[model samples]
Target: MAFFTKEQAKAAARRSENMLDQVAGLESYSDERFDVFLSHSMLDQDLVVGVAMLLKEQGYSVYIDWVEDEELDREHVDKETAERLRQRMRNCSSLIYIATDRSGQSKWMPWELGYFDGYKDGGVAILPLVDTVNSGFDGQEYLGLYPLVNQVNQRLYVEDASKVHSDFWAFVNDPSR
Candidate 1:
């Protein structure tokens, strides 16, 4: 019943510094089934990588653009990049929006959320990483429409406050969910 916070994410980053040993790059969209297409700000590269590793430890295949597609050039905005992301999103069962102070600045996060929301019919959750559990994602827009992802003993869960809270694993495992 604990919220996922920035401190925990940072710890994960420290827990394992290198991802090359963990996830194999060049993950084929057609060959792989990803549990979450991590929608995040490229500015927070380390944080996102940590989150991906954390999720992988929980037995989920995560699709991170730069990780999977190393050829992806974030600096160069192109229609193909969007299309590639679209294809990855299609292969994922859910999308986790890594909400932080830098999250609002990402051009792809909103589009990823919107596309996944429409494509998966609301298969998106915001993993709001704040400085403290008591703090929240303030001034961020359009994030409340979906559930929130949190951690408990390193396990992931999704919950819509005042509604329902369930395991992140269960959500991905359940087809009707």
Candidate 2:
């Protein structure tokens, strides 16, 4: 549950804002099946919901498993449920793994990430939502070679809400970076 220093958060926010400005023109090109599939631990529902809402507000199609379907029993995911989850992953252009403390321990998050990587041939962007407002993240190494949205040195992670819009759109439009 360690948090970023105020100064570090501010710097990250500024970087986010700059990135947004640079990628402002990319909105027109980002028309994918699903803009993002938000993968997170069930324990961090509220935070993930907020992030999904923000993305949706920016006109990005976000797929959050529990929110999109009421039939999913979080406590008991059966074979059918697993297949449905894989289907959703296939439909997404990007996967945003909410890299929080709880997510690190979740059995499904890593599996989903692996599935996406294999299905998309590493073409789809796999971004980590680090430095979240509520939860702390394990070190960047925990992401295990995946590109991250909120790493300390990376240009994508931003604390400012408005900046996130630009950063995300930019990432989706050009996942190769």
Mind giving the per-residue lDDT tens digits that candidate 1 earns over 1-177?
A: 466777777788888777755565654656577888899998898788778878877788888887788877878879998888888888899988898889988887888889888988758888877888767555365787888887666677788857587878877766863
Off by over 4 Å in 2: 1-32, 123-142, 151-167, 174-177
List clash counts for every candidate, in order.
0, 0
lDDT of 2 at 15: 41
Clashing pairs in 1: none
Q: List clashing residue pairs in candidate 2.
A: none
Tens-digit lDDT track of model 2 for 9-110: 344444444433343333222232677888888887655655554455457777777655555787888998888888877778778776655676788988
lDDT of each: 0.79, 0.59
lDDT for 161 (candidate 2)? 26
